[model samples]
Target chain A: MKTKKHENHTYIIESEDMERKNEMLLQYIKEKVNQLLQIMGTKPLRDEELNDESLIAIDPIGIIAESFEQVLDHLKESNRQLQLARDYLQAVFDTAGVGISIIDRDLKIIKCNEKQKELLVNGVSQIEGRHCYEVYCGIDSPPLICPAIETLEMERAVFLKEVTKKGKVFQIVTSPLRDRSGSISGVIEVSMDITEKKRALEAMCQSEKLAAVGQLAAGIAHELNNPLGNILGYAKLLLMEQDTTEFQKNRLEVIIEQAKRGSSIIKGLLEFSHQKMPVFERISLNACIELALRSLSDEIRSNNIEILTGLGTVPYVMADPKQMEQVIYNILLNAIQALEGKGGIVEIKSEALNGSVEVTIKDNGPGIPKEHLSRIFEPFFTTKPVGKGTGLGLSICAEILKKHSSNICVESEVGKGTKFSFRIMGGVTGNV
Target chain B: MADKSGINLDVINLDIRGQICPACLLISLKEINKHKGLLRDGEANLIVKTDHRDATRTIPDAAIAMGYAVFVEKKKGYYEITVGRKDEDQKA
Candidate 1:
């Protein structure tokens, strides 16, 4: 009888321990649910009260255990769904070319994809948790025209806005984020680096303006041609007169020279305005360059610039010979001008590589500045002071080559020299 | 047998498909206009192929916006819309 009583006592203690464990688990679950509600930005649920009908005369242990089990199951299922959604979203973000970022209501970057990180850090570090303005716009606080804040307040998507930061332009769009309860939660910003696009647009605008100017120049040149011919004809007539004095002859000669200069200027303007379409024919590029050099013999000799020709045997290229000659002439003239009355070596080399003919014209003159390198092919962009350079030389050469589906690339180092390489499509001679 | 009251007119046929957006719908209309003279003369038809179902439902609305009389029909996997002169539809 004594041992039986001890067994009962032991059973009671063990049962009490199990009940306490159950209560502790319920408390833990309740705390976790509260935490989850806080994360989801929702109100927490109230615990069972003594006067509550749902809990009236109910066994607290059973109720707590069953509720905790249900909560656990729900959390597990929700966590699985959340993980799947996160994976799908991450996949979309990674594959999208445009940069994307999510900012909380506080303007702190809550999430950012690879492209966003690439644009903000230039392929460097992670940008998560950083303030959007500080990291991207380099501002301590958000700007007055903050798209993210506006999107959140208006609860609507905004169109792309062009913004410049750190000398680079970006096109950014923002959309409001809504929670399950249809409340605005945050903002999603999509940005694209539109600097190159903007530059291309500006270039096209400039090209259109140049085209208009070319038309005007053509008209002016046509009108000036007739007067120039008259002046030249009269000057020659005066020079041939038998009764003309030495002073008169000298004056006539000066008039003739000025008229010739004006004629040459008109010719250049006509060439710029009337760019003939390239008529491609099979021709040896080496022969063309050699002939161009021969044509420039007088100018090259007067400048005392040494001309070195490394004319490698190249495959015949289908190109307009006259246009190619003009291209070479412009390059050689530019090289001579860069020397600025000083003598330097101009090397011309040719090679056939990878189904293309590469012709390089290198000059040992004061090289172009780094900033001016890209703008060299832009119309009217010249380093030479006004009237000294029309700046159409390189631009016209580029256009001519571009018509032949060819390209010209320039590489220069300050104080060193400049090398211009022209690549043309080679004729397929049945040999790869 | 004094007079025949009912008169039938020929129906114009036009097919447009592969419409993914409003822009595509507009482009299809522009393409149809290439045969506008023939349609006016009641000689030729406009045919297009599209793969978007939502755009099919929206075609009538688009036709209304352009002040066109259109008849829409649904086949197994496509929608065909006919747009032409209103008086020429009496033969259908």
Candidate 2:
């Protein structure tokens, strides 16, 4: 009986211990579930709604796990869209027509596109992470017109209307790239090549100036021509008298000679101002060239200049033969004068091409200067001494060719030579 | 039982009109757990109509987290939150 009593008490104590452990484990589970609910941004779990047994049965952890999976799905979708946007922007940045470059506040180049490389960067040169000024402007330091500095200093967009770099004109626009907090971190530079546009504008201005000068020249020439002719006529009439002294005869001859020179100058001005429209006819360009050379043959021979001709079998071009010969004469005379009596080669080549006859006149003499190339066809723009030339030679040639539906071109180097080429229509189809 | 619609639409409605935040959340979760399989398979919809204002916010959030579509409707004096799939509103 005593052993039975001891065993029963021991069994009761073990049973109580087991109940306490179970109660503690249930409390721990409740606390953990409540913590998870709080993290889900919700109110804590109520003990009344979920007793220890019900909480375990519902498996709140599993519910929260599935909730997180949905959240993950949404996040992944957002990331995918963001990546697509980034790729689209990158494509636009690369294929833009104008040069584009990205630079940091320190002026270090971050990215440069294909046009930027073509416009500013040289082949096989490293530019990434280097100073932008060094690569773009080819200088050790930033230039006074550096748009990067302007953008950083102004903290806004900067547009430089005209910038000359690498001997080409550009219009530069720079915009600041700011971070989320609105502080500038870098800059985006856009450069457009406007070199051709600038040259075209200059040519337009030059033509306007030429038109104004031509009008003034015509007015002066008109006012002086009548007086000059009368002076020459009276002086010649007095020279014919028999009672004149030798001294008076000498003075009359001088007056007549000077007046004739003045009249010739006036005639040139009138011809330039009122350039006649061509009376088109089927004329041989070779015949025009032959006549011009024949007229200047004495000068050509005296200067010891060699005439090299490669006249191909070309058809007759529709032009005014008189004006065409005049054009050839002016160009050849200029070439002879350019040789300065030092014997040189003048190549005359003609060919039939694309239903047009193209002619080239080249001289192996001291070429025109680099700066005077564009102004060579302008009236009265002369490099010759004041009394030596009238300065209307090339300009008048240009005018005559214009009437013939063609233009003149001259290419010159300082020490080498000059080449001039122009084309006139020749095929039967061109006649219509 | 067939309603006036004459289709056997399974709708379980829990009316906790006087409840507040946490109690509303716990009761909604218990009901959702009880019918998780039915709700996913579009077989049943769980409708919890409560007067507690916070329940509208909390209940819908928790249901959506559990991968169930939820719609909340405000009636005369109480907010009703429905948690299920397609045709859940028509069934309610």
Candidate 3:
């Protein structure tokens, strides 16, 4: 038994009575209501009745039950629509051609598209949560001018003109990602592969430089010719005088030889400057190539470079024989030099294709770097050390090929090799 | 233009601006030859100013070849060449 005292009154309660009172008389009432609910078997309790304690407390009888049911139904429909929108956005993200990535403020890649995975990370799985600099640049730290870093640091959009990574060029744009509070959270990077565009820009710049150099060379060569000739003639006259000592005669002979050499260089400059037009004639390219190869037979033999010539059915083209020979000779010399004296294979293949004669020169040697490949055809641009290269050979070849209505293009992969290819249109008679 | 430098001597001023190469050299030579009498007596000097780069080399070389004492001074965008006969003392 238990006794509880109140103001001016006392009540006695037995333990059995207390237990009966705590047994929840409301539960019996709930059972009676459930029996009535069983008549409507398809109706489930509203979510507010089960999980929302606050709503249950505010309205014990569920006076707002209908309203809560309608609200829950509306929320369900809105969620379905939102899920559909999310799926549509996901499809667009996956199907985009350009590489797109979202990076967190800590420079970790949070999300990337299919193109980003394929082109940037070399199709590596599990790129998410990896550091962006490590995946894109292969460096442990971000480069000095990384667009993502700049966007995050400056809290603005940043654009990079051209960035070369893994031997491919890309135009990158990055913008800051902001949270609902209007604070930057991360950066979104969009990159487009622009290798072909970069190559075109390089070619334009190279041709401009070549033109300026040619104009200057032509002016100087013309002025130098008269002085060089006067020097040569005077030296010859002095050499012809019999009343001269042996020492004096030797000096005059040396002067004459040097002046003659200068004259030859001036002649080459004139040709390079396009002052002399090539006299075009229908010629067999195979024969011209053979003649040029013959001229370098000794050098090739000494260097032990294996020459593989694959001459297919080739058509005759309208070309200047001497200039064409020079072109072949220059490209062959370049191929030999690329071998670096360690001895490698030089492949020369000529074939007729697409109404033109195509020539390809491939070498298994140290390949050119991506940075230098663009400027290789520009005059005075060379990778060789000082005194080892004149830097005019390829420019001259390009000039000659341009005159023949053809163009030279190179494909090189670092540490693999280089391939130079050109096409020259055939004459009026296809088989001439 | 001649001035008295505490001595009665003559100076000839020749200007060949906007002239190119050998023309500037040739004109400077003509002026030097015209004052040859004063030059021989060591009574005058020839000063020629030209804005041609080639003339800087050609005029000096031609003047030196013709047995004249030449001095070249480069001014802003131009050259001043002074020519005189070898002094008797210098010849000795």
Chain B, per-candidate TM-score: 0.57, 0.81, 0.79
Q: In terms of lDDT, which candidate is stronger, 1 or 3? A: 3
Minimum summed lDDT over a 10-residue window in model 2 chain A is located at A1-10
Q: For each predicted model, how many residue pairs clash, with residues at least 3 apart or on different chains? A: 10, 0, 0
Summarize candidate 2's per-residue lDDT along A1-432 as a digit string, tens digits: 122346888777777787898889888878877887776668777778668766766677666665555546545765897899989988998889999999999999999988889888876378889999889877888888677999999998999999888878999999999999999999999999999999999888867876886797778999998899899999999999999999999999989988987877787778777777888888888888889999999999999999998888788788988888888888988988888899999988888888888888999899999889878888888887775567788888998887777899888988899998888889544322
Clashing pairs in 1: B8-B91, B9-B90, B9-B91, B10-B91, B15-B48, B17-B49, B17-B50, B18-B49, B18-B50, B18-B51
Q: Indicate which candidate wins on lDDT.
A: 2
Give candidate 2's total backbone clashes.
Answer: 0
Global CA lDDT computed for model 3: 0.76
Sort the predicted structures by TM-score, highest score first.
2, 1, 3
Chain A TM-scores, per candidate, are 0.69, 0.73, 0.66
Docking class of 2: incorrect
Q: Positional deviation of A272 in candidate 2, in angstroms?
A: 2.8
Which stretches of model 2 miss by more than 4 angstroms? Answer: A1-70, A87-97, A113-131, A138-145, A153-156, A164-168, A210-220, A231-265, A297-313, A340-345, A351-356, A387-391, A428-432, B1-92
Model 3 DockQ vs. reference: 0.00
Model 3 over residues A261-332: C-alpha lDDT tens digits? 788767767777873567898888888889989999987998889999998878888888998888888889
| Candidate closer to the true structure by TM-score (higher is better), 1 or 2 | 2
Cα lDDT, all candidates: 0.72, 0.81, 0.76
DockQ-based ranking, best first?
Answer: 2, 1, 3
User: By DockQ, who's the top model here?
Assistant: 2
